[model samples]
Target: MKKKHVLRLLAAAVTMGMLAGTASCGNANQKTAQENPLAEEADSAQTEQEHESAEEVDMVFRGGTVITMLSEDDTDNTAVAVKDGEIVYVGDEEGIETYISDATEVIELDGQTLMPGFIDGHIHEPGNMMTEKKELILPEGQADLDVYKKELQSFIDANPDLPIYKASGMDLQAFPDNIADNEWMDELDTDKPVVIADVSSHGNLANKIALEMAGVTKESTPPDGGKIFFDEEGELTGYLSDAVSLLSTLPIIEYTEEDFSSAMKEFQELANSYGLTAIDSGGTIYETEDPNQYEVLSNMHSAGDLTLRINTTSWAGQPLEGKESDRLIKLLDDSQKYTSDFLQICQVKFSLDGVPEGATSALLEPYTKEAGQEEGYAGTQKATEEDLTAFVTAMNAAGYSVETHAMGDASVQRSMNAFEAASEANGGTPDGVINKIAHVNLLTTEDMTRMADEGVIAAMQPLWFYYDPFFSAQEESNLGKERFEQEYHIRDMIDEGIIITGSNDYPVTADFAPLHAIEAGATQQSPYEGEDDDPAYIRNPEQSATVYEMLQMYTVNAAYGAHMDDIVGTVEEGKKADFVILGDNPLTCDVKAISDITVEYTISDGRIVYQK
Candidate 1:
């Protein structure tokens, strides 16, 4: 994702001349005035008659199938009336017309189905934003490996002196030969590093420079359950993940405010393109240092340009004593209170285990494939129970919600116990604090009931089944037959009422698309119709959810996951007017057709953020 920074520079350089030319003339003011006449008029509407109806309404949406996800309790075709950014009326369209004044701007949905803006509960939104800020290395659906490599090389050839050249949309899986083998980089100038990130974002290939700059050695052991690839000769491989020792021994590249602001605009567009009216992102700026750097979502909120309602969170830095931990808690508590109808601060996130492929995830038993034979102990544990108790306890006491990463079942158990311990220490049930287990690829039955009874949210990535062989074929190879069934039990969790939300761990497994996430969760099928279906990996195909259930998970269920259930989850009156106009009703569409359906428009807080 560092590629975004470099791309932004090139973008600015190319536009520098154009900007200078425009600034030299005075026509810009006239154009701005002509474009914003209505806004000017609205601002000046203090005339006699205008004053009488000044507070009447700002806008109205008419003539569409309003699938108001007002509440999980309310169903489809729910119309809404907007006043400012909030929904003033929601229900049958009967009396809604009365709210539409002559001054109101109304849009006819043209039979399009409307629902609460799709909320993707999990996303590396900055990474997604980074992708958008970049030049198109691969056109839409042009993800073939050879073609992608050729394009990337072309980019490198075009920019000779740029020390680092990186591409984002290509897939690591697309190449038959693993990237670490160095076959791909030999053709390029290894003097300057080139890392082509996999679409999943979980792993990336580093040319010689990035590896040396990070000081990775073939003998480099991972800090946790991370994997650092090594050549057969015990030399370092270019691949890095879980083993990066991430926050610790890394050099801090100070990013400028300009970089952040530019990235924010791109990320906002990325969210809207996928019909995301709301999203919960996994990045530090969102949770810990929101004030330090204006996160794209934060900037959007401040400008009231937030087209998608966002509830983003990150975590505390290393351990701190009474003073450090306490200060962190206070910070989150103070920020979580940032109650905008558009952006809401929700939880603090922490990674308990590492990546699945890296085998950093904490599992009770050693992985079957790597087993005790491979170089290390079954992934290293980050925080001990005492440490976890202290951290979680402080967060719980501060009334801050948690979104911890625990891919392995053992790690999941540990995080859950910490939350439980924190609850017990805090005088009562902290169950409603909205702590969640993200990326629960391996959950047990007992965990299910405990989550439901304890009210812990399960923020899961449904896109996994579409990429790689997600079935236990690999884990089973290492563990056994029984281990596989524990992979994805989507229906079982819903049945247990383990409040859930679907997400695309963008730059990791899938792009952040709610429709694709839902289609994967509901049909257990890939969105690409041309590709072969995964018979081996689609675990428990019978466990797929109903259209309404999947839809709610994308809409109300996601809001509920973010603890904004009463606000923008629905298309009802008195709620935020955040919604999307779908090309086809997801609920009414054929099972497989859901993923293929496009969004015609996306309205966030009654603002037309995206229109097809």
Candidate 2:
């Protein structure tokens, strides 16, 4: 419930660095050649002969239960052969042995299981990169208003000279009115500018000084696609959503290029520890006039600082900025400058709607009036239908996919309609791009079928598929009981033949472990074993997916979603040598035990990057 829980999970991930280091592996390989010089000449001659006779490979992994994830024919005891960062062979030991030479590094897998490295389909690079920095003050867990005040005060006392004090991770539900009251914030610190962000990161609470510092007044107009709140007396309530929240918070915190690069490294390392070979940075936006995340990632990839693959989609900016066709087209054209094996720009992303928790999602039907919202409120849409359709059509015609943030049924329907029309207008489905919709928490049966038929990818956060009283209790008020009870139908999508991929949407969720997501998808239950397990909290038991099905969503399906399937999805010939060695086979192990399995080794680009 708090950011501390996420940090704790990351703390555990840091320990995974103890897995054998890549440096040690290289050193061992080098030592083998230096130990003996007298026989080196003869060994070299013999090795050359063997290399000529055998199709020389750099590494060979054998003696394990290998789940190729390609098909049944390629499963079980499959030895993998890698040469120059690409898999040369994946078959029975007898067949793969033909490619192994004297210089090949042989890795004995023992009884462990080997599978494709996890691909997190959706996440944010900025938050994941900046969590450890002191600029952001994070509370331990579900803290009340008093706890937040104490923490904020402590932060102010530590950095008293800071011109602006910005802190995120406050649970809005803990406030008296379920929102950070500007009056309460002012009481805490009247002198310093204070802007506390909601846990969702889509909104923030600004004190009077902070609001004044941002030049916001009762007569001030908020940027497009954002909202500024006020009380009955027309006084600023200090709450800002979307564009306004970003505008107020980002400028106050001083972040340098070095900080961003360092954060990227940390994010990559943690992901490697979890056996992730690639991650799709769902979307990244900057407060600066020109976003530099593309440059930062490119520099890292060029300098050999990037150890995992990064696929990014440029943010479409605030919706009110008008149609940015020219700017977007230029950005896409510029994407050609950094296309590499480690990094690439893939799509454009736009927030079609807000979240349901705040009653801002574009729902087809009105929400229950019990939540204190207006009688006919169906939430707000960031852009008009005409603009959305035009944007999608333009992007698709340009050979680029667009990932839309659609959480409600109405938003989903509109997005799907745009995609369908664009595809039809283009004379066929868009090529070289996988159109995606993030967080389809609610959807209609017909739309779900349409999504499947159109091949639109579902970038889902299965970790959010928890059925708990604390969350379910707010369903009727945010959404009617009927819709609330039918949320996140995982099994239903699988049955509909939709291409689904599992993601963490990190910084929002504490954990991004694929095993946890797989288990949650199969059970439609919470992963926190220590938390509430009441049967009454189950969201939809009948929507449970099969373990194998969920595994596909995490691995091969995820790779397909990212358009990296040709290079690194399954353990097969001519693919990148990326494999995760696990303590137990997730497919054969007890379903509940999947999340308990520890990663033993993570091999990327023909090298053992992580070993347990």
Candidate 3:
């Protein structure tokens, strides 16, 4: 048998840079031909004479099942060679030796599965960091008020010096009548402001101090695209939903450029550990009050510290009309200054509706009685159809794609209408621009066909495809059994030729692992441990996708959605050398066991960023 060898350049001095008190996510041995004097001289010398042997590459992998992601039928290639951060060769084991050299660092894959590094089409950057640093996580699935009080008390007790107490992962359904009041939180801490966010992050429960700090009164009206719950006597319940939740004066920790930079490094490491080398920021870059987020990302790109290719989006605020639309356009144009090969700002995001679990997502039909709504309550549309259409058209005309957060069927329909209007107004979606709708949890069959017709991309969260304990009940209760069963039609949408890209919606989603999502997408069932074979555990099993399709959702399909398909997403020659090596092939493993497969190695731009 031919010895498996991965080539690496040993002669070049590899320098790793530390940024913001943390090791940068860039490949430790990353060196481009332009950056290395030796490599440049070698190239110059090679141009002057015919080489006696094949050209020496920077790195090579020859002993793995290379899933190139270029074609489903093509599987003969089993070796890949990298030079100067680009794939130089892709062929069988016998053909790889030609690129081998004494200076090459050979990486033996040891029969692992090599494939393109995963791309999360939608994720919140530094969100995981914020959750880790700021929010005290409450126990999931506890509906009892005492249980929450105990947890909140413990959290408050542990962090006595905090100016404001903050906790997340509160299940809204756990509260009475699915609403929380300030009384309980005030019982815990009346002096200091206390704010607790629901598991969905779409709602917040604040105590009296926090509400007073935000200047919330019973007479105050809810802001546009927001909801302020009131009790039977019209007293403030202190439960804010959607845009109103932003009113909570949760103390914003002043994060500096260095802090954001370090947080980004940590985020990259975590993403790489999950086999992701590229991601779409999902509109987190400009959502925060801190101005240094974009600057930090730009600085990282300039310093070659970015290991992941990030496609960033600006938050196009609600009610995009007239002056606001013009302002958003200017924001988009100004964002171009931060654009780079690794960091792109070519998309704008809109929150067209809230989630169904909150009964705020727009729907054509009325929500079930269980949602505690009067008759004919179909939820809030948030953005007017006219405004959405106009904004989408303008953005598309300006050569920027739009990503809308639309969870309900009505929201999905409205989004499709906007995209359709954009196509008509702009002639078509501009080249390199792919309009996306995130968290397409409830899509109509007709709109699925329309999505394919309009070339709209579905930014889906496979983690939500399963029947989880906490969320599943809430979703079912809110959406009713029939509509709940219709949610996340993955296989149906794929069959309709709609381009589906996978995402974890990280920080919001407990599991950010693509492998876990792959299994969930393929099975339409929970990929968690102890999940039984009970039929009820499966959610729309007929809508389950195959493992290969799931892989494409995270690889080529996601890359295409992010407009990075031309450079990454495949192991083809001339593509960037971004790859993930797995201890077991997801395709060959038992469908339920795919999530258990270990990520052995992750390489980005020809350098190893993760090893396990």
The residue-by-residue lDDT of candidate 3 on 201-302, one tens digit each, is 777888888888888887776655567777877888888878554563556544456666777888899999999999977866223432356677888888
Candidate 3 clashing pairs, residues 3+ apart or interchain: 6-60, 6-106, 6-107, 7-59, 7-60, 8-58, 8-104, 8-105
For model 2, where is the 10-residue window of minimal lDDT? 7-16
Per-residue lDDT over 457-561 for candidate 1, one digit per residue giving the tens place of the 0 to 100 score: 777776664323422233444444566555667777777767667776665543567787677677655555553264543556766777677777677667766
TM-score of 2: 0.87
Of 1 and 2, the candidate ahead on TM-score is 2
Winning candidate number (lDDT): 3
| Model 3 spans with C-alpha error above 4 angstroms | 1-53, 141-144, 154-163, 232-234, 245-251, 285-291
Model 2 regions lying over 4 Å from their true place: 1-53, 72-74, 215-236, 243-250, 285-291, 320-323, 532-537
Provide the lDDT at 107 for model 3.
89
Q: What is the TM-score of each predicted model, taking all chains together? A: 0.79, 0.87, 0.88
What are the per-model numbers of colliding residue pairs? 12, 1, 8
State the weakest 10-residue window (summed lDDT) of model 1.
4-13
RMSD of candidate 1 to the truth, in angstroms, is 11.7
Write candidate 2's Cα lDDT for 1-612 as tens digits.
313211000000101111111111000222211134553455656754654476778998888888987554456555777899987666567766778778999888787888989888887775646744655555646558778778788888887777777777766567654544677775575487787766566677878877776787777776544566666566778877654543444345666777778877777778778888887777752333334777877888778777777777787865524357668867767766776767666678888877666666778998887544668877777877778777887777776778888887888888998889888888875556678888887889999899888878888887667654544455446787788776788777777767777877777665677777777777677656664355654557787777777777767777666666657767766578888999998888887778778988888777787787
Please rank every candidate by TM-score, starting with the best.
3, 2, 1
